[model samples]
Structure formats: structure tokens, C-alpha cells
Target: MAKNTTKNTEGQAPKGVRKPPATRKTAAQKKAEAEAKLKQQQLETGEGDNTPTDTPEQPNNEPTGETAEKEVTAGASESSAGQEGKTTETDKIKSDANPPVGNSTIEDLSDDEFDKGKRDGVSDDVEDQELMEGQMKLEDDGSTKIGDNPMLTDTKDKEEVQPFVRKTKIEKTSSNVSIKSLFKEWKKDQALRAKYRQEAEEAIKSGLPAPEFEDETTLRFDLAIQRNETWTDYQKSDLIHTVLYGYYLQPVLVEDSNDGKKWFIDGKQRLTTLMTFIEGQWALSKKTKPVYGYKIAGFKFNDLPSEMQDEIMDETITLVRIKNMTVAERDEMFVKQNSGTPLSKIELIRAMHSELSEQIDIELSSLKFFKEDLELTKKAKDKFIDVELILQIAMLIEEGKDRIKGLGADNYKEYVLRLKETEQIFSDEMIEKISNISNYLTLAFEDYEMDEVKKALKKVNVPIIFWTAITAMDDNLQPKLFGDFIRSFLISGYSVESAYGKSSQAGSSKKENVLIRLDEMSAALSQFIDMIRNASSIEEGVEQFNKHLADVNGVDREEGEDGERESA
Candidate 1:
């Protein structure tokens, strides 16, 4: 039952090709994936003879849909049996003894796209449609209707009919309406409502059974009235006015309203849905005061609960109006909205670079960055890790200049991200590429007598120190590169080596290269302010690091790398 352990030359992984950590799914997950694949195959073979009968022991189809239904039943039993025949763990181990390395497959080295609105990797069960479902409002009778927001556009079965395409986050497309699209959509909805209302009134007056009208309603409004915390009566009244306009202008929108071009800065779908329900008088249901009468989307002036309902209703239809601004304005607008949440200096700096006026924001973010480092170390959370900062500092020390060449900023962000994703994917040899960065940093800071490096290390708040150390190893980098860098970082203030392994400090986990990397990090950051100023992107800044590295390589080459650079 055992196969010989030999590497397949053809299956060899492409050089520098790192594999994603292959996660083994649970039985339920595997079953779902298998079923999905089978369904897809069935679709492809519906009218053809391509039904897979490669295994005589498996179900054979009759080429009829009825036959297919029966075959599907039979296939379940046969497939389960086939699954049982898969290689055992021991056998798998023997066969995989010489598996392929990510040693031919090419991957596009695209920048990581940040999805800011939601947390990363929300469960698949949490569909975008869920947001729409909550987009409900009471019909005059207190029933629920689905929210009509463009974000929920794909939720309807009809929208799914077309073959789908997955687009990258940064991909440029005409219809990827920026937050600016809110006003335009609102105006469109308003016009549509007015036209329908006029036709209905005419039909009613003409003694017709029913007037032509759109069956559903959507959430769309261009006003910044919805915030999670509290909604004022004035804001509520403003919202009512917007909805009232929709009802009055039923068949003819006053196109002259100057506020009709705004988009969502916040509460995007929620605001729009509230107004839509009110305008269309759709059925909306909730826990209490569940029905906001579809007769008109008015809030009861005397009732507190009614006021709350109005707030919810307003939220479902509110949007922030946008102006025709350059890309810089948009970036600033984004940053301002995110300001409520604590952000790293690197993140702020990256945004600031797009605007000459906002360049000073980097200092504020830097202070935030320092605080984040402290917090990350205390909590050992990944978010607190200052990966970009460490890389910026490290590359500067090693390259002598402010930037890395080729891929740009010394591949700082890329390196950090890869380490995070494939912490276990790359081999020890491969890991050295990053580990050396840590060592070089340590040696670079050793020459400086500052307490700041020690403080940063002692605080042990950020994950950056650990990664910097990990990357400073050979993966051929020595301790010298970052030791001076670390020292310099602190000379502007902190010392780290004073309590090398002292038990009294906040972070006492002193692995051999840990302190060394911390020092390197300190040194890199201290001396690399200029590198930061020159950085256009995370990669570009690392190029400045190449200049720092040139000096480091020269020193290490001449003095010969000390035994201090050896792996623990």
C-alpha cells in the first residue's frame, strides 16, 4: 500500500513560488466542496456523454435528466467508498517524503488590496444579502420588503443569472461607483417614484383597477444624517423632508435640487432603504413599533420609540454628499472617516504622501504607531505589529539611501505579508531571507548607546520586532546591519540592551536574535527619517534601504561577519 518516496520533477514548484498554507477542511467542508464540484461537472455534461464514468465501480449515467437524478444517488455511495480508499496518514507521509518545493508556477506580485469597510475574511455564510434583508421597512400593514440598494443588487435571483466575474479590489471599472454615486442613485429613484405616483393618481382618477407602479422600493438618499451613536430631532426632520419630497414629487422630480449628486460616506445602504420603503409604502417589520406606516415615512413627534424608529429609517436611506474633488481629496476624506479608529502611522503616512498639505499628519500617525507598538507587545496581537515601520527603518540602515530598488521599498510590506500568510509555508532556508533582516538590524544598533531601542524592545508591544529579527537571519544578513540602526533609533531617545534578559521587564522573552533584531529595528528607524520622507510606497522606501545595506555589506565583508550572525 506504500508508494516509493521520490520527488516528481514535473511537479516541482517554481523558484521563489511560495504556496498558500493549504488548510485541510473538516469533513463537512470537504463534502460541500466535493458536492459543488460535482454539480459543476454535471452542468457541463448535461446534454453530452461527458459524465465521468472513469471508474467502472462508480455510478453510470443514462444521459437522461432522470438518469442523472438516479446516478447522483448512486454516486454518493460510490464516492464515499472511493474516499475510504484514499491513502492513509502513514502512507501519505511515506509518499510525501520528497514532495515538490515552491521551487515554476508564476504568481502575479500584485500589491495587497485592503478591504477597509469590514473585517478580513468574514464567513461565506455572511452574505451581502444579509445587509439587504435587514433593509426592510413596514408596509402600511407592517410587513417586510427587501431593501433596494445597489450593494444588494446581486441578491435577487435574477441578478445571479449571468455568468459572474470576480474583480480585484483596485481594478478600474466604470460602474464601480465611488461613494459619490449615492446622490445620483437617489435622484434616479426620486424621479422614478414621481413618475409612478403620477401614473397611479391618473389611473385612480380614470377609474382603472390598478395604476402602473414599480412593485418594490430601494434605499437612497444624499444626506449625512445617520450615525450609530445618536440621531437628533433636527436631523430626523431633515430626513423626513427628503422622503416627503419623494412622495410629493411622485411623478415629477424637481430636477433643480442641488443636493442630488451626493454619495455614501457612511450608512450607505441603510439610509437609501429607509427612504425607499417610505416612498413605495413597502411592508417593513421589526421587534416593536415594527411598522413605520407606508402611508408616509413620518416619525411620531411625541413618541421616543417612534423617534428611534425614525432614526433607523433615516439610517436606511442616508448618504454623505460628495463634491468633484481630486484623488487627494478623496483620500483625505477616507482617512478622516477612519480617524475614529486608531490607525498606524505608516497607514497615515501612506495616505498623507498623496497630499502636500497633509504631510504633517505622518508625525501624528507616528506617535500612534509608537503607541500601537506598545499595545501589540502587551497583547501579542498582530494589528499592533509595526511591520512597515520596521522594514522602512531596516532598509534605510542597510541601503544607506532611502529606497529599495526594483520592486521598490525593499519589499517590506510584501515580505511581512508573506511571512504572515506563509509563516509555515516557506522552508528554513527560505525563511532566512527575512531572518537576516533581523540580525542585520541588531548589529546595526549595537554600536549606539541609546535607551530607546531597549525601551521599544522592553515594551515588546509590536509584532514588528519579532518579524524583523526573524527576517534578519541569512536567509545572508548578519547582526551588524541593524545594530547601528537600532542604536540610532533610540539615540533620538530609548535603550534596549540594558536588560538583555531581565525578568523584571514587560517583554522578557529574550531569544538570541530577538534583542539583536530589536536593536537593528531601533537603528533602522532612528537613522531612516530621510528614508521615510522619500518613500512613495512601502516598497520604494525599502530601496533607500539598499543604500543602507551597501554600507552594511561593505563593513561586514571587510570585518567578516561575526559568529554573532549564526542561527540560534
Candidate 2:
């Protein structure tokens, strides 16, 4: 069962070309050289038949349609081995890999049309039609419909079509006249409801749906109104008025199974609004609206007549039941649906198909410093800014400035997108490095019992300087410098300029600004270290540091000399 390890180079060269006597390489080296030659040939000819064994295996993260296309272009720049006339290693790998059918091949695409195909080696199991399933179909009147086309047919005892494409669009029908009888409340059995909740929570944690829950309701806004903490009074009022005016609510997407269980995919806002009104959680706004059946605009559900209440209940909301889509695909639909709506970066990250952001967030949250010690406003959890800062720092350490050239809060939306596309960001080694940074920070900060140090560290720009400084120092010596470095750095004029100057405030997130700030802080710390090394006493060191600060900040000490910069 032993495989052949020898290279068969007998007739590889073209006719009339005299072969040079081969070097006395070992079998492994010979095999490797042969592969290199084969790869070169494939790249030159755009022939992907030759298999290159040296290429590293791509990670298992599957990109959606749009991102897959991005991979093709990104893949080109990713390959360092490309030559003047040769196709990129990404092209070679993609040619050999099982690309999703119907996707444009590497050879057909120009450099501009490249998909970072290198990262998309894992073939998507979800079929092409399944991907196109929930795509919004526009009607003549301008309403968006989900599941407008019947992707699958239920005709029994008939020949199944090879490639089914629904030719007929699902037509819109008038709303039911009898309000109370047309629609029923989305009620699930007790066991199914519990199961749905568990799955919904898991989806909220990570976009990947639970095994059994994808087919059933993931989130029921009617039953789960208490859980949505972000729904505002103004938003609820708008929804109530919207319903009272008899405007058609957007179709709520659901995954309906043969067993008749329904799982919600989108339209939670509209659904929650309707239910909140019916339950009398909030009355209609003072804005005049009695158009449906009500006499007064500000009537609660109970204050309305029985027929009016029945009319609201019987009002039909459109339902788009999905089938044949993967859990990732399902999550993608929700993300796309909420694309225009205002949402936190972390919330959007959770709805994404990748697990990297959520995984990193979970990891950061587990740290005691992140939970209790670090000063976080209540908005931190909702806005997820804490995790966002952690991720930015993690990337700063991981990618270095060459890759993250434009890193800052200004381009954070773009930065995170690229981070998701990048496979190396979430490696076990990288995650451990982040953990080490966190541990270093916790130990270095917590060791000092001074409340002043803790309060100073809570400021926004301080951690960036502290973290950058600690990371720049010798690992063993980082803890030693923490207290002195923090106090000294805070007492510098540059810290105040860096933290509060108009230039710093306006350009705080600019790439050049971030680099300059870090560089100057490092320069200041380097001086402090030099003072520590040569000065005879702590008093002498402080005096030297105070004098050195003016020079570091490029301010003239000849005109004025101060004792020390004020601590934050």
C-alpha cells in the first residue's frame, strides 16, 4: 500500500532540449522541485490540471455570494509568488478547487473581477437556487416580496424537473374583509416554544442556527417583546400609527416545515409593533388617526369597540415561508433585510455569516477586567463598543501597520469587513496572543491599588497608549513599567494634547494621527526608560523626565519650565 515518492521527470522537457544532469537531491526535494515546476507551468499556461502539494489548506469559513466574488480579487494580491506573465497562486489553487457552480472562473475574470478565491476553497453545500431563494422580488406597485417565486413544487406522482425555475410569480391578493377571522396569532406548543427560544438565543450568540431550530421560528416578537430592550417609545408609536392607517406591513419571513411549525426570519419590528398595540402596552400617538374603525386616535386596544379590535386582529400580514436554505443563508437574509436600518456594529457582526467577531466578543467578555474592572457605560453592552475596541487592538497587534494602514474608528466598518474576509485573524495562535495581551493588561493595571491610576486608565485614549506601550516593552519588564509609565505618561503635556487637542479630537481616528500618537508616546516612554537607567535617584529621574517632556513635545523650555504636567 506504499505510495510512489519518486519524481518521473523522464519526458517533462520539450523535444531537442538537452537536459542538464539533475542535481543529487533527495526524493523529497526532487518531488518538491517537480511540484514547483508543475505549478509554474500551470500558472504560465492557465492550465489547472497539475496538482501542487505545497499550497496550504484554506480555513473552513464559507463566504456568501458577494464575498466570494471579493475573494477572487483579494486572492490575487494574497499570492506573493506571482510572476510577470504567470497567473497568481490564488488562480492556480482556485482552478484546482471545487468552486461553486455558476460562479465566474478565475480565467474568465479580469484582475478587477477577482474574488479572494484563495479563502473560498471550501465549496458551499447550499445550492445556487437556495442562495437566490429569499432575494427580494419587486412587484409593479413597488412593494418588496419574499418567497414570491415558488422554488419547490409539491406535485405528487409527477416527474421532477432537473433544474427547477419558477416561471410564475406569486400574485398579491386583497386583505381579508373580516379582520378578526383572517389571521391567527402565532402560537406554538409549550415544548416547541422553549425549543424555539433556545435556538433564537443561540442565533443571537452566533449566526449559525441550531440543528432543529432552522425549520421552526427562531424569534417570536409577539411572545418575546420583553426581551427586546432597544425598542423605543417613539418607534413603537410610529408602528401603532402605521397600523391604524391600514398601510400594508412588510411580509415577515419565516421557515415553514411540512409539520406546520413556523420560524421567523425578518420583520420582527412590524410584528412586535402590532402585538404591542393589541396587548395595550402602549396606546396610539396623539396624531389623529381613526381611519380603520376607531373613533379616537389615542384609544388603547381595550378602549376600542369590539369590531374595531377584531378588525386590527384580523388584519393580514404577509408571510414569506422559506425552504431549502442553509442556516448561514438564513442568517444572511436577516442581515440583508436590516442593512439600511440603524444597528450597532456588533449587532451587524452577529448577523454576519462568519463566527470570528462573535467568537472574539465572547472571548473578550469572559475576562474579569472586561466585565467588572474596566469602566464601561451601560451603552457599551448595547453599542458593543468595548468589544469593538478590543478587536481593533487585537488587529493592531496581529496584522501590524503595513496591513492595517488605515485602521481607526473612522474606517471601522470597512476594517471589520476585511477582518471577516481574512482567515488568519481568528487562528488559535492569534487568539492566544490576544489573551496574553489581556492578561498582561489585567495584571499590570490591577497590581496598583491607587484609585487615581484606575480612574486615569478609564479615559479613552489612555488604554490605547498603555496597551501600545506595554506591548512594545520587553514581556517580562511590561509589568514593571505599568504604574510608573502610566503616571509619568499621564503627567506629560503631550498626553493632554493627544487626548484633548483640537487636532487630536478631529483627527483622533485618522491613520496618521493614531501612528503619530503611538510613536510620540513610545518616544516619551523611551526617555523615561533612559532616565531610569542613568539617574542617581527617583527625585533626579522625575526632574530629568519633567525637563525631557518639553523637548519630547517640541515646546521651548528656555521661555518657561514647569514642575510636571498634570495627571489626568
Candidate 3:
């Protein structure tokens, strides 16, 4: 080689020459440095005297200083090289503190512990070196890691994270009154009022007995009688306009009570509208027509002009009087008066004034479960469907589910008629049974949080469940068992297919379907009740029932396939 001397920079290495890597401090060197730094800090703080002069006593057979360091280094090197057969002293301490969870059999661990371990971090079977590496990465970079685990950061939107808000239940009102009948009755009363006014004039001239119409004011409503219908906002507003615009208003039909009270038999809607308006209880609708060249919409009684107010207050409402009317007769007349436009069957049933109807209206309909928990639709409640359901349950109890075919219109009507004709009431036992069943159902639904079941519950399912509970359930059968049975039977796929599915598909009201459903459900409930009664605990009973149900479903599937093949 040619003689060539290269001059390098003061601190730089020669070009094309590699620099040596920095040497790692040995364990003893690191310990000595740490002790020296601690001594320096203590001396600066004037607390060096308290420093211990002797090393803390080590446990027997435990390695210390150089021997321990050499063993740890060798173990680490082996682990890093993928030899996991030997455990180091550090690993032994960790194993003592948190026993190797993976080495323990699954049956040895409690459900809660196992689940917590899974949620807390990685499995213990993972190599100790790898876990340390992960922990080191986490400590060094201030980031979470678990052996290349995927991040589970929340990706939900604000709306998804917000607490759920339940939909408001529909408003229920019994205000589907018949305006057509009111108009027809108004026309007939107009003719009668004209005839009566002529007669009153003649009677004043010839000194004869004359018909008299009561003032629109001073009229009273009898609270004893349940009016079959109520006026809608539109009907009340239209009546207000009719009176304000000088149209003739219908006369109220009243029955003279022995106590001298004018019991309203008909025209309640019209009379109430006018009277309520005069009392300033309500205002005119925004859609009210203009009157006397003035916009009257949103006007209360006091808002009307002086003359118009006087006209409304001074208007004569002919009171058609009858005497000695029984409650049934009164209800019948009320129904017939509104016959031009029919009321709902349940509404008609409510108007029957039967003991059963009274019980359903005054007692059953007022139940917390029936009113709030059942959460019937607006139309259903407006039409007295709750009342109807109570009656249906009562009927099932009294007539025996086998005897009753369906809960059709005719069946309910007949039931109400029979109760009226025979002057009978639902037995105390029957009423209590119905109430108990309803309360039980409410509690069951709530305890299990079975919102879906409640929403999908149809009218047809009511009687079947009621009958099943009545026939199969008893004091020995716990409420939990009952709830579980009901929830499973109503919602579980296999139970639905085997019992409620086919019958509820169509013609649920048919006698055969009703009986079949009744039979199937009754059998299932009976078996469940027996199972719960014989079992030690409700949970055990439920588990056994579920297993039995699964087995039954398997058999049913096999039989179904066989049947299909034969049919083909």
C-alpha cells in the first residue's frame, strides 16, 4: 500500500471506520452507582446519619448480589432466545403474587375471576419475556400495548352514548262522541222547540198549560250516570261557533230525579261545550269561523263582544224531561239516541250499566297495572279495550276456558247481556283472581325487563295466559318461576313454534285454535310449575326447563322433517 496519512476532525472518527457501541453497566456497577447517588442526595439534605449501614437481611436460600444477577441475566437471555422451560427468580416472585392463571384448570376458577382476568390483561401462558417487553414498551413510550392487541377505543357517536329515552305513551280519551246524532237530535229538537214556543204563546193568550224550556244556565249534570261518549275539540269548537253565529243549539235531555236533580240523558256534549265556554274553562279553536264580521278564533267567553256574550248566556236550551228511568233504561236510551252513529262495542258494553261493566270501569280500569303498565294504545283505551280485556279475563274465569270459544264481539255482548239479565256480578273470587293475575303479570314483565314481550303481546294472548295461570299456577309456584315460564313460553323460539306460533298465525279466535293454544300452554305451564315445585331453587328449575324444552324442540324438528318427507 502507498503511504497515505489522513487527518481527522478533533472529535470525529475516520471516514469508513465504524464506532464501537456503548457498553451497558453491569448489575454491580449499577448498584454501586445508585448507592453513591443516594448517599450524595442524603448528605446534601443532611439526613445521611439515618441511612442504614448494613444491607437488609435477605430471605434464606434467596440469591443476592452477583450470583443473583448472573442467574437473572442467564434466565433473561434464555427467555429472549425463546427458551421458556426455566423460570427466573423474578418470575418466581410474580408467580407467587399472581399465580399462573392459565396453568390452573378452568373449573378451579370462579366465573367472576375468569371474566376479570380476561378483561384485565393478557393470559399468563404468554412468555414472561414477551410480557416484560410489552410492559417495557408501555412504560418507555407512555402507550398501552398487549402483544399486538387491537385498540378498543370508543367509536360511538354522541347519540349512541346518550342514555336511552323511552317514547311517550299515547294519550287516552273517551271522547269519540257522535256529532251526526247530535245534529239529528238538534234538528228534531228545533221542530219541537218551535211547536213548544207556539204552544207557550197560545197558552199565555188562552190561559192553558204551556211547555217551558230551561235557561242555558242553571243546568246540572248527574255524576251518577256514566255518559257513553264525550265531545272532541272540533265538535266543541263547532258548537261554540254555531251558538255565537246565531245557529240554533240542541236541547239537553234530562231525567227528573226525586232529589230534583236534572240528570242528563242526552246532549251532554253540546250542553257541556256551551256551559264550559260560559265558565271560561276553554277557548275557541284557532280554526273557528268568523262571526259578526269579527274573527272569533281563540276567543273565550269573556273575549266575545257584549251582545254576543249576552246572546250565548240568554240562549234557551230546551230540557226534554222524563221520569222514573232505571239505569239500564237510561243507558239504552243513550245508546239509541246515538244510534245514528254507532259507538265502539266496548264503549257500548261500558254503557250497559251492568254490574260487570261497573266493576271493570270503577275497579279494574283503575288498576295501576291495567292503566299504566299494560300501556294500551290510544285507540284501544279510548274504545275501552282495557275494560274489554278485564271482561274477557272475567269471562274466561267464570265460563271455563274450554267452554268459551273466542272473545268476539258477539261473545262479549252475550256475556254482558247475561250478567244484566240475570242480575249477577263477577264473583269475589273471580275478581280477585283477575286482579292477582294482572298484578303478577305486571311484576313479571318488570322484573325481567321484557319490553319486547310486552310490545308484541296481542289481545288474543291475554285470555290464554290468564287461563293458564288460573289453572296451573298456585301458591307453591313462585312468582319467579311463573315469570320465567311466561317469558320463555311467550318469547323463546322453540316454545313459540311448538305452542303459540301456529294458533296465533290466523283465526286465533276460532274455537279449535283457542282450545289448542289453551291446551298447549296449559300443559307447558303445568309441567313448568311441577318442575319448579320439585326443584330446590328457581334458577335450577328454570335451567332444567330450558334443557327439557331444548330436547323437545330437537324431537319436534326430527318429527317435522319426517312428516315433510312423507308428505312429499
Candidate 4:
């Protein structure tokens, strides 16, 4: 090996020397060399004409060649040893300045360069200083001179940079807040009324009509079509308590008539209670809590403080409106509205509007016999019991009790329906006949003074009395005689177990029972009328009937004693 000293001519290493491994440059040396090469190229081509040609160089500004490489390697080794697991500031800056290939840091790269880097798996850093300078120039002159990178240029010059506008949150005002909160604030601010008054005055001074606020509580009733009063005082008091306590109230239903009137379709009771209470017609119940530090129990609307009064007036009532409906449709709607609390059969019949129903309501119900003689309470009248009785009487008179099948509830409903379909007009003669019969009945009951008979006459026995009177008496029939005949017939039925008593006791509404009762009563009445015809006075006739009743009682007592002895 020592003898082989001949060198290879092509600059190859000598045989067996294994050419000492080539020196590898550190990252810093390579970066320095690349910068030197770029400077030399720029100088040779005169590309950087602004370079200071006469600038003096400083001593030891930088190392050169092998010495620079040696220094760079040694410095890198020292840095590597010192910062084994940490990155220095200078190293970080250098790393950021020279990002790895395919990194997303070079935003201003040309499309061609980007594509080439993508294909070659290499990326180069874009000089941020150059890009920033180009951007500043472009902004200054509104020109596109951002090097060769079209990505940095603004293509849409006409597009505006929209200024961000933040939405403002709405603040709750007194008018838009909850009613409870509004009332609370109103109570605290006692000057609210003065404020409103001042506003009204200003409005008037400005030649504008003073603000006329409509009261929501003011509602009208169509007396002919609306239902009668059915709510009791206790019910009204409960509603008043609900109002005082601020409980939710259901909305009132109304119909806007063609005549520009608002009529109540439903909620009559509720609306009326509210209106009456506000008008001081009734006092609040004991259940009402102290409102605004004042005990409102047993207090009228006038007794309340002005603030509480205003709160009641300011109470909001929702209204649902219907328009242009017929009576039948209204009736159907009323039934539907009151489905929860059902109406009575007679009430429902009355709701079915017809000329006859109207006559019963206006004429018949208003008659003295029905108004005074029936002895109906306000509640009974409100339930339409009077109307039902009067309607039944009228039907019997018109149909001639013999022609009617029965006077049960179902039969009565059918008759009402028939009346509606026919729109039957009752004649003056029929009406007069009914009135006379009613008058006779009233007078007869008043003069007879038989408590048991009179009591029976008020209820189911009324129709039988009417039938008997019509059958037995004529136009010239004396009231005294007629009264005497009725008294005798009732006494005979009461003193003995006769057909009248049996028929009147049970199944009274049955057709056969009604006929039997009528026949028995009419026969007795006929015989009494004939017996009284010869009598000199009503007293004499009554005396004779009493004697007859005594004889019948004597017979019954004898029979009862014999049966008692047999049992013993």
C-alpha cells in the first residue's frame, strides 16, 4: 500500500484511499452562500441600480470561504449542544423566515409557482417585505403592481368594504311590558293620572279632539235573542273575586250586527257581572284580597281608591267577534259555546228562534197571569220555566188538548219545532180565548181559598183545570159558579180515591193518564155546573158540594175501620 503512490489523472482518489467523505454544509452556510450568489448576480446584471456604489465596507463585517464554513459548523454544533430540546429566538426567526417546502405560509406565491411546488413537493418563502411594499404601493395609487402574484391584487375594485353594524337590543317600555309590571309601576308613580290629564289637555289645546278612549267593558245585549239571567249572586261574587285577584278571564264572544251594533253572542253573564260591578251595582266578595293596602271586601266600586278603580277600568278584556249570522246559526253557536255547562231543554227550545218563541217571550210571559199568578221566583223565571208553562198552555189551547198525543217534554219539543217550520201565526181570537181562560183561572184560584186545591192547580194539575173549564163552561158561564164547580171537582178527587187523584199522582204526562184525568175532571165539572145552575148563590153551591164530600168521606172512613177490625 505504501508503494502505490501514482495519482489518478481525472482527479479521482488514489486506490484504497476511500476518498475522505465530502464536507457537508450546515443550514446557515448554505443560506449565506445563496445570498452571496444572489448579490453577485444582481451586481453583474445591474438589476439593483440603487445599491450604494461608493459605500465603504466595515472591517470583519462577515467571514468568507472555508473560515466562514468552519465558523458556521462550530457555531451550529455549539447551538445544538446548548439547545438540545429548546428552540432559540434566532433559530425560531430563521425557521419562520425559511418555512418547510409545501408549507401554507407562502400566501403570495404565483399560481405557477404554487402548482410547481405542489407537483415537486417543494415550497419557497415569499418575501413578506416585498409583498408588503407592493401592497402599500397598490393602496397608494389604486394599481395592481403586486409583483407577479395576481392573488394579491384586488380584482373587484367596485366592491365596497361593508362597515359592521351592531344591532341594538330593544328596551322594555311601560306600554309594551306585562300588565302586572305596568300596574306595579303605575301604583308607584302616582303622577300617572296627572300625566294622562296633561296629555289630554295638550291634545285639546292643539286643536285635536281630546283622546277619547273606549271602555272595553261597555257591551250591549240583544234582549230578544240573548239568554235570560241564569247566574246566581254567589257565581257573580266568585267572578268578582277572580277579577280582583287578577285571574285569567275568558274572552267575550260578540257579533257585529248589520246595523253597526255589537251584540253579545256569549259571555252575557260574565260581561254583565263585570259591568254591574264597575257601575257599583254590587259589592266585592269577602274573598277579595286587600288591593293596594285597602280592604276591598264588601266594598263597592265607588269605595275603592282611584288607583284601584283605574286598574279595574284598565283591565284588558279580549273579544272574539262574529259577523252576519242568522238566528239559527247563532243558536247553534250558543249551544256549542255552552257545551261545558249544558242548557235546559226548555232553554234550548227558547233558543230556537221562531215567531212563536218570540210571542211566548214578549206577550205570553209578560201577561199578568204568568207574571203574578204563577208565583215564580226570579231564578225560576230566569230558567224559562214560566215561558215553558205558558208555551205549553198556548199549545194546548191551540191544538185542543184532545188532538194532542201527550204533553211530555219530547212532545213539547216537537211542537216547538212544528211551530218553527210552519211559522204559525196565532189569531186574535185564540189569544183572547187564552187570556180569558188565564183570567178565569186566576180569579177562580183567588176566590176558592182551598189551599190544597190551589197548590195542586199551580203545578201539573193546571192543564187539567184549564181543560175542565173549557169543556164545562161557556161564554155566559158565571165566575162564581165556575169557581164552585172547580172546587167541588177538586174536593171530590181529594176526599176519595177517584180517577182524578190516581191520574194526577203518577204518569201525569202520559196521554192516557192525561185523557183519564181530563175526562173525570170534565164529567165532575159538568155535573157540578148542572147542580149549581139551580142553586141561588155561590155559597149555596159550595155548601152542597161540601155535604157531598162529607158523605164520600164517611163511606171511606167506614170501609177503613172495617178493614182495621178484620186485621185485628
The candidate that achieves the highest lDDT relative to the unseen native structure = 3
Q: After superposition, how far is residue 47 of candidate 2 from its true place, in Å?
A: 74
The candidate with the higher lDDT, 1 or 4, is 4
TM-score for all models, in order of appearance: 0.22, 0.48, 0.52, 0.54
Cα displacement (angstroms), candidate 4, residue 45, comes to 85
Rank order (by lDDT, best first): 3, 4, 2, 1
Model 3 agreement with the true structure over 128-201: per-residue lDDT tens digits? 53543333223334444554323433432235566888553322212222333333444455566677788899
Q: What's the C-alpha lDDT at position 195 in model 4? A: 65
Model 1 residue 539 CA deviation in Å: 39
lDDT of 2 by residue, 293-394 (tens): 545557788887776566677677667777776545655766777777755555665455245554655576567656655656666554655666666676
Cand. 3 TM to true fold: 0.52
* Alpha-carbon deviation at 292 in model 4, angstroms: 10
**Cα lDDT of all candidates, in order?**
0.39, 0.54, 0.62, 0.60
Q: After superposition, how far is residue 443 of candidate 1 from its true place, in Å?
A: 23
Q: What's the lDDT for candidate 4?
A: 0.60
Clashing pairs in 3: none
- lDDT computed for candidate 2: 0.54
lDDT of 2 at 46: 38
Regions of candidate 3 where Cα sits further than 4 Å from its true position: 1-230, 275-286, 298-310, 377-379, 446-453, 492-499, 530-537, 543-568
Candidate 4 residue 170 C-alpha distance from true site, Å: 40
Off by over 4 Å in 2: 1-232, 255-264, 271-319, 339-353, 365-374, 378-380, 409-425, 443-463, 466-484, 487-503, 529-568
- Return whichever of 3 and 4 wins on lDDT: 3
